[model samples]
Target: MSDYILGSHQPLAASYPLALVDLDGVAYKGHLPIEYAAESLVSARNSGLALVFVTNNASREPEDVAGQLTGLDIPTSPHEVMTAAQACARLLRSHVQPGAKVLVVGGAGLLTAVQAEGYTVVSSTDDEPDAVAQGFHPSLGWEHLAEGAYAVSRGAIHVASNLDLSLPTARGYAPGNGALVGAVQAATGVKPFSAGKPSPAMYDMALEKAGVSSALVVGDRLDTDLAGARAGGYHGLHVLTGVNSARDDILALPQERPHFIARDLRGLLETQPEVTRENEWFICNDARVRILDGALNIDSAGEPDELDIVRASCNAVWSFVDEGGEFDNTSIPHFSTL
Candidate 1:
């Protein structure tokens, strides 16, 4: 098999008017905005594009995720978000009757989201449920894994919020929802139906909620957001501030590679075909600095010095974009100083 898979070229005209920004590494790791992420969202909204915060973090519900963004000064409503939890809930509701007992193995958010969807939540200590919903959380135990396996072995529908094996964190990489799903599958020898990023169901829900055509999916991880965008026929923008940070990381991507590469959410908002030259500096230090508009730009500034420059430039570009600058090419020289 080929190590590198070049993505199909998607022109700007084919891009969507909606923007899907991942919260966990793209916009913010938790509740706080990662540098210029808040400003970027504001700019996208002002541009008349519908913005949806699409995340694979099953630990929080849509309302909670929206509230977290709003608290961080990023304007968002619960309806303006799509989450793995919501997808799992919708999938369950479609397959099972309302109030069907579901054994939940994840976070409180997953439990609450399933219940909100009219499914009756059950615990491992309770009788075996009619379905099993798996979401990732830090406190998952071996006992819960056994229960999930038991429930699935009993012929319960197994719905996984996402299949992301790892999650980005300030501390470092950590196992995610997919880890728990793996444990259950190992025990029961059954794979689950995933309803998260990279799944068309989640994107369909988001588009339906936003009532928009085409979308720009922004994410830190290439595996999920980018994959989902490709499957859903949307443009994808990969940000370096979140998870994967090198050109090699993206060059080796399986199904989803970004149509645009940015330093963060801020860089994406400033992204335009006309502004391609200005944006080229953001990824200049990346190993795979491709020639776009005769400019040498890297996939991501992964070096120590370049990382700092990317962050600072992302912040400044966000400010300029917010102020209505028309994609001037002046900032390229200044970014080189960092």
Candidate 2:
């Protein structure tokens, strides 16, 4: 794998056969569609690229998630959605019998998935379940977590649909399934095997469902989406529509850097500019950046495109850092420039 970001001479929609898209941040935030998300996705689909919505969310059934998309003016179907619940259920099938009892500590989506895999869904440790599956649900309380802890303490294999630390809500960030999983871990001293992003399981299932040889993984978060793509040996495109900002992205660790960065889904239509080394500088579009005496330097103010500046900065910074060089914050670009 290359340490540098990947480039595309052609528009991403034409270069890749499919796109595995993350939901919350990339497609929408809360109940509203992100700016230009619906239009870009529609355009990408029209350009002959299959779009599969992949999410770490495990609380809602596929149809319900699809309905949310459709409601956002983005035409979608349940078949086009893939959830962490599915991956968790698939994982459970390997460790248990065809009809083993599974204690559920989440909501309808996770419950439905476990049952779909031919497992009996139970609600408590008293049932002596063969395994325990936990996910996010607003109704989940201390009692449910206690049940998961109790079940896991009894030697039941624990699986989490996802371990996302926070969930975006209408108000702000709220505790996600990972927080609940942490509570269970503290009580039972067992860390549940994660089945979502940053794990290849969900992406593997998504690739199969999309049935494409080449795909681009698109999302807002680097740790889950980009890191997951790197783990799965696929190209990743980062969008700045949610969670992480351009400034945050440029400073990401090597393993979490995306192959491409964009302002939004609209990036699908544009050719990814190449960041090439020239003398002592790395250039993208018109922006040029270089490291000088342990500090980063902007050799030229060349581009009006904000994304290009980020791209150029990432290339320069990453290239230096990967080579065991230290960063000097004096050269950091203004946040607004990013």
Candidate 3:
């Protein structure tokens, strides 16, 4: 809350040895690659940042996910991909015995990861699974949730890949794994230990596997990606190409605030200008933003980069919020062009 947002004198590629990147909104939107995602990541790689694709999607295997990225011109291998299913499997390993029967409430990704980790995957409560692992799969039905609930109610350890409420799709946002997990929770009145974003285990595993001391977490979601970075004690880079908005960053809860914000992945190459406060004005590059009478104001006179204005606006609003001030969010300027 004390303006921990950072500016970079050196490009992120030079400063961080690895980048733990999210897959859904940052690299691709559903089945399609987001604009400039592939090329910018290639640039980051060329600048010496090891790119690791981390995702909460548990429907597809790592091999299949890597193939999708390759088709998008990203050129990735299975080893470079880490899924929520893998993380959930790791958590399950610690809580349950090796080769234990585990109920899989998701799809091939979750099933494959659990098997790779020495768990016997089962589908029904009749298997009397030792634990239940749940993840997001488009094909999930009530039967899957019923099995998970039955397993949990009968005293099996429950673990979830992630609790993301919605999944981004080619059409629009759809129910994600969290929504499905809720069904089990509602039936049994029990909660699951999540293994994905905002849970340090996933990022911790990614960093340990990469063998890097310093890494940057890059993603499009505030509650998951950015919040996970904070929980893991790492810097987070937030991009506007995803579900969150610039105003969302401004009004974010402390745990969900990002260390840096950008319009897209191209921001990785550029140096971030400092957002500093001078009296009542918060400035970033040529943009000046301030709050007056509970309303946010931005100087439209200067031809500052649109992203710079967003940075300034967020700084001003966050500073105000930190001081126990409140304002109408609608009064905040929407730099939608960014």
Candidate 4:
């Protein structure tokens, strides 16, 4: 990609009228707020960028998610949040009839969403549910999954809130909704129709709700967040504060590579720097990297901002891959300074 990926005449806050931000990794790790997440978002809003907390987490109600963000000092309301539960419920409508009996295996968020959509939510498959909706819930265990398996095996349509295998939090990355969905799928031999990130359905809904064309999808995970942004034709900003790292970005697949990469939400305040390639060298300000003989090499010795080196190397590696060039990912060094 050219420096069109590096357009920086203005800050991202001014360039995009809205920001569809991910929740798990971008806003907080577990329950604790990630550094700069709150303040930076506040600043983005002050600068005219509308903010919406878009998440694949289907366990928590939007009201609770909003409360958490507000407690962290990033003033928010339930209307400004969208959850996978809501997305999955809306998706279920297309597969089943109105007020269809649905076996819900999640938390309050999923149940409420299904109820709002006029689905008859039932905990047991004995209700002969028309569909089984699965989402992430901290308390979900073998029994919950078995219910889904039973429902699907009995001819109920299977639905998943998201396919994220791991959930990011302060404790660490835990098995996410995808893992649970996997158990149910494995038991029933049924593939679920997922309704969250990596699918443009959620983004389409959020964009319509925000009523804007130009929006940036800010996130941590590449597979869901970045992939969704690409599929939806929205510019994506991958932040290092969450699940994926600088190393992950360097080796990302074409559809999952971010339009911009930064250390944290603070990236919203500044314009991304241009990354220019000269001969075999990809240069970003004072930092430069080159891919030669299937290895990544730093062209300059002194340390540039760690992110600068990352920016340079990502462009270099991506360019290499684009041309059918292959390289050992191990040749890329890890960056520490944020």
Candidate 5:
């Protein structure tokens, strides 16, 4: 909340009543569990901090998502999960009546959600559907996207789960739901309303489902997870376990910067030290960083080399950029946390 990393004397796991955790990056990447994710989450739950696994991936249902985490040794219930598919359906209710015909442009997860919300699902635009709810699924073909485009062109209100441009896979990054949604937009020349991260749709649902006033949004994507937190008026904790790196975070846009940065979920169980500005150097414990003659330099490599260096560097760089300081992007070195 302070312009950069905020210190917590108490373990972050017990600091807030609820945590709206991002699934892919924070808990697990794809189907594999991140290091210490299960243990740290279990500890937080045991300590009475409730958690809701929120995700922009609308391909899977909450039950499936919960099952995936439970198999990873992170014991979870379906009620503890929230997906963008569910959020998309909720968003539809505001624009159309319950039982209104809707075109679902994704897979079973989205179809099931739209139906559960009492909307009649239609596959084609000829059904004269009232709205189109679009999400991502791997089996999607050119035909599906064309259908969404046509439906929207006919004045069906278009809504998508999220605008994420890419999806992560074992083989590397692949096309995400947003990429497909872009095709529909290009065809219709009308942008779809996004109901995923950076829009606060899922976060709003998570808050109501958890019945909490404030929450900590944790994730690896700055554009979606962290940006959503800022938009929803909640604190964000950026974890360097997926998608984004420490340097990516150090130079994050002001609107997407996180309140806390950590190596992993273990940060939830650890105290974060203060990053202070003293003269030209930004200090975090023994770590210090400053820009000298337009060259960013680490004056000191603090204890826990990687963490402290990142913390110090973020404060120094963010402060510099915000104060109208300019430097070449390459001048900022990337500190590897892996």
Candidate 6:
């Protein structure tokens, strides 16, 4: 891993004409916006960067997601949004015959999006459809999977909105769309054509909608957002606001780590001279964390106290900076002293 920080004259400038940020884990989780997320979006917009909420969560339609963002004081328009569900719908419409019968195994949002694209949605009670599409939504279950499998087995095209197995939540991570697709695949012995992150389909759709070559993909997860950006030939900005933490670097890192790492949206938006050297920075939910000598060090606590957390944090930081270091929680001593 290269430890060098970006410089001002780097060929790839940080200034982007548009930014595509993930919704659930990047901008907001549930009802609350991640700390500094709304402000960052606002700042990006003020800087003349077009903002779009690109999400793999297919539970909500673009308008619904945009409405939620507007409620959170983040300015967004319906056209300035893209969802995996919408992309899947578009793909089905473009490739399949117009008004083709389609079976949907997902939420109301997915059904609504497909219907809007002029496809006849076939339910379990209805006739077997020409195509079966799966989108990630909380309400999907075995019945939907069975229907999707049956449809695919009967020669319907299997379309998946995304292949992410887990989605970040406040409690931790939960089964995502990929789980449902796995079930369908197992039952029917058919693999789905994915239309979301880690696949360039959705990113291509977003690029066409945004109409810009200079773009940045900002998200918390490495596998989905960052991987998608890399595959689609765009810069990725990793924000430590939701699912990803410093501890996840050891095993969960994607083939390509993000071009830039920020503690949160605020850290990303803060104007600083380009990094002249490799620097380590301490990141905490609190603003007191400081950046020192291209590495993060904590100085707030007294020497007699908070040793364990500090050490663990230090180890995590070092793991990121040092390519060969192993992060074995059991190997590190004095873990409880902090």
**Cα error of candidate 1 at position 292, Å:** 19
RMSD in Å for candidate 3, one decimal?
1.5
Which portions of model 1 miss their true places by more than 4 Å? Answer: 1-16, 271-338
List the candidate numbers ranked by lDDT, top first.
4, 3, 5, 2, 6, 1
What is the per-residue lDDT of model 3 for residues 1-338, given as tens digits with 9 covering 90 to 100? Answer: 34357889888778899999999899999898899999999999998889889998888899999999999999899989999999999999778988999999999999999999998888789989999999998888888789899999999999999999999988889999999999999999988988998887778887889887878999999999999998889999999999998878888888888888888998788788888888999889898989987778888787987778778877787778878888768886657586
* TM per candidate: 0.74, 0.97, 0.96, 0.97, 0.96, 0.77
RMSD to truth, every model:
9.9, 1.4, 1.5, 1.4, 1.5, 6.3
In the range 109-143, model 4's lDDT, one tens digit per residue, is 99999999998988898889999999999999999
Clash number for every model? Answer: 3, 0, 0, 3, 0, 7
The lDDT per prediction is: 0.69, 0.87, 0.88, 0.90, 0.87, 0.70
Total backbone clashes of model 6? 7
Q: Give, for candidate 2, the lowest lDDT window spanning 10 residues.
A: 298-307
What's the alpha carbon RMSD for model 4? 1.4
| Residue 196, candidate 4: C-alpha displacement in angstroms | 1.1
Task: Tell me which residue pairs clash in candidate 6.
Answer: 279-294, 280-294, 280-295, 280-296, 306-338, 307-338, 308-338
Residues 24-132, model 6: lDDT tens digits: 7788886777878888788768867777788888878778888999999897888888899888888786558869999989887789889988999989635968898
Q: Which stretches of candidate 6 lie over 4 Å from their true place?
A: 1-5, 8-14, 93-95, 249-254, 271-338
Give the worst 10-residue stretch by lDDT in candidate 6.
Answer: 4-13
After superposition, the stretches of candidate 4 with alpha carbons farther than 4 Å from their true spots are 2-5
TM-score of model 6 (CA atoms): 0.77
Clashes of 3: 0
Q: Model 5, range 78-140, lDDT digits (tens) per residue?
A: 999999999999899889999899999998888989999999999898999889999999998
Span of ten consecutive residues with least summed lDDT in model 1: 1-10
* lDDT, candidate 4, at 103: 95
Off by over 4 Å in 2: 301-304
